[model samples]
Target: MQADIQLLLTADGSHTVRHETLGVTYHSIHGAVQESQRVFIELGLQAAFERFANVPLRVFEMGFGTGLNALLTAREAERHGRPVAYTGVEAYPLPPEESQKLNFDVALGTTFLNALHASPWHETVNISPFFTLNKQQTSLQNWQTNERFHLVYYDAFAPSAQPELWEPEIFQRLACFLLPGGLLTTYCSKSYVQRNLRAAGFTVEKHPGPARKREVLRAISPPIL
Candidate 1:
């Protein structure tokens, strides 16, 4: 696997980027990671959490990458005192030493980096009173879990770089883990991606993308009767 480390700028002039499999971080010119945080974490995850305002919010994340999304979620859960269970799947997990540099406090400011790195990896680990993070270091294609997720952060590499992750079969498998009314959000809003989500039995929507991008994708499953 290739690894890239570089800088990327957000619409608000924030910087973020770290590659695990692809040299040269920061997609194109603008900040890919920053856009991800804005679109997925802030808009997608937080919105889903708000709609389901019960304790113990369960979140599933694809492409753990630099652990930025998890760190952001941890900060929000801790600050808001909302119990959260976060499950992140990554084919190639980033080393703790590398993840420590995420430093959400510097950018988002919530001491999330420390908490995330401090949380030991095992079968499961509780990071704080409000946050429990479980990491699966395997391709999501092979993951199996009956646990239903209220929200999913689908932040994979671009379609051009990694086409396999965008396949319909993978989406179909992932859709099974989402409970009725669960929502999935990603930065890509291509028509093909939306079609895949729909084929997987989701109600898909095309939304304005973050930063320089044109559009994003959000999907929701109907509640089980």
Candidate 2:
């Protein structure tokens, strides 16, 4: 059964969702927008642009959740007039009723958010001239794609919640789909997680995190020699 979701107002007045059964929140309770901006936008996206600005950027996300990360990415794409192809894979797609109620629009604009939710799955839809989205209603484990990505917004549930997803084999699978020198950012900075990333052949860096957390992890795939 799908876990019931409840809308939550975070410290920054942005909305996140809480899983009624699992007791997990979609984003940080301290401040949702800041966390996404700091980790995904500022760190992940910007870094990708600096290195690979010659071509349209490709992004893959583990959890589509509330479309917060995708919406933010679209906004950046429009601002810079750079093309972005984003793929969000979700095992349990959020119901439209709940996803539509999120307040990310107030801060990041809703045009893309609305389109992101309404867009059909398994099809490439242009949410904006510069941003195209492919929403897949499936888990990463079962997802098959030969498309290589430049950045990965790994926003899955915490390791404590889904231990299987944090293993070395999973990281190896993610690394396989990423282009050489591609970046992967995740909110979890656990020591063992970093070790798993290294075991999967990624070079990991610990970055400062947002409220209630000290650090995050940004892992880079080995560059071609």
Candidate 3:
């Protein structure tokens, strides 16, 4: 089902899309860019870099949405001279008219935001020397791939809005694609979600969230026996 969406300015002056039907915002209401940087970038990608070093990172994102996380990750890859193979899955993509209004290009000081959205789905496109993107137009439930990932940006709509995506079975399914010691980060800290991740064989941790959010989750796939 398509959502009736509207772009709204968040507290940190970044733009986020709100689904009127689901009553949920794409990113935190606090600050889209700030939350993305903290949860996905600092805690997710950077943390993975510490363990993996300069090796090319295979990153998988659950929901592409506004492409903010991908944009930031691409920029980070460029800054650090690291290689990143990024894949984002979005069942319902935002049209160009809607995505164009986001101010992330100005906020991040890069014009590649448009190129990100323009790239064709289900095909790998080299956004830059350090960043390669594959935008998949499918739901995580239906999308299948043999390639494992080093990091997963689980930016799905909140559990309250999309309960199916956060269930234990789903976590178990996604865990299959995570390399041993791989990391998955999300701006959600619900107790049941943590339990679900644990049940799916992940070691979970809670970190300080960005902006007004108090806490977020970071889960790591256990090393192979």
Candidate 4:
């Protein structure tokens, strides 16, 4: 089925698009520009990178909508002088032309906007020495990789919108992609989602959600053998 996309102004004064079928929302709030910096860049990614305190950090994101998460992550990696290797998966690919019209730079800053535009579409593209963003235009169901990730941003649609993606099998697949002691964070606070993650072998926790959100989910895997 074709996805229904519409643009709307969010409370944060950012432009956001809602994917009706997936019941997913994308911040056109400069598109990924806002989401990347706020959700992952400042909160999740930086915290993980600091705890790791390593030269290079590896990140994997389940939903790459608007590429906001990738752009923000690249900016953070550059600021810390740490190299970041990122892999993102998205089922519906947006064209570069449409992406450029997002105006994410005005709010996210010109540098981040340019870096985001420079990221290539339809392939794994390296934007800078410290950051690399790769995208796969396919659903998570088709996802297969042996690479282990240190951090995962679980941004899939809500269970009500895409029940299959939120199933135990999908969470199990996510567990397979993580390195020992890896962590997963999401904006969702659904008990069923937490239960699924636990069933898939993750140590799940409920955390304070972002602004206006009541709760969120954080999951971690034990150290690898």
Which candidate has the highest lDDT of all?
3
Write candidate 3's Cα lDDT for 1-225 as tens digits: 355899999888889999999999998888899999999999999999898895899999999999999999999999999999999999999988999899999987987899999999889999999999999999999999999999999999988889999999988887888999999999999999999999999999999999888999999998971
Relative to the true structure, candidate 2 reaches a TM of 0.97
Q: State every prediction's TM-score relative to the real structure.
A: 0.86, 0.97, 0.98, 0.87
* Candidate 1 clashes between residue pairs 3 or more apart in a chain or in different chains: none
Q: List the global CA lDDT of all models.
A: 0.74, 0.90, 0.92, 0.72
Tell me the TM-score of model 1. Answer: 0.86
Q: Candidate 3, which ten residues in sequence have the lowest lDDT sum?
A: 1-10
* lDDT computed for candidate 3: 0.92
Return the number of clashes found in candidate 2.
0
Residue 59 miss distance in model 3 (angstroms): 0.2
Lowest summed lDDT window (length 10), candidate 1:
20-29
Predictions ranked by lDDT, top down? 3, 2, 1, 4
Model 4: lDDT equals 0.72
Pairs that collide in candidate 4 are 15-29, 28-31, 30-104, 32-68
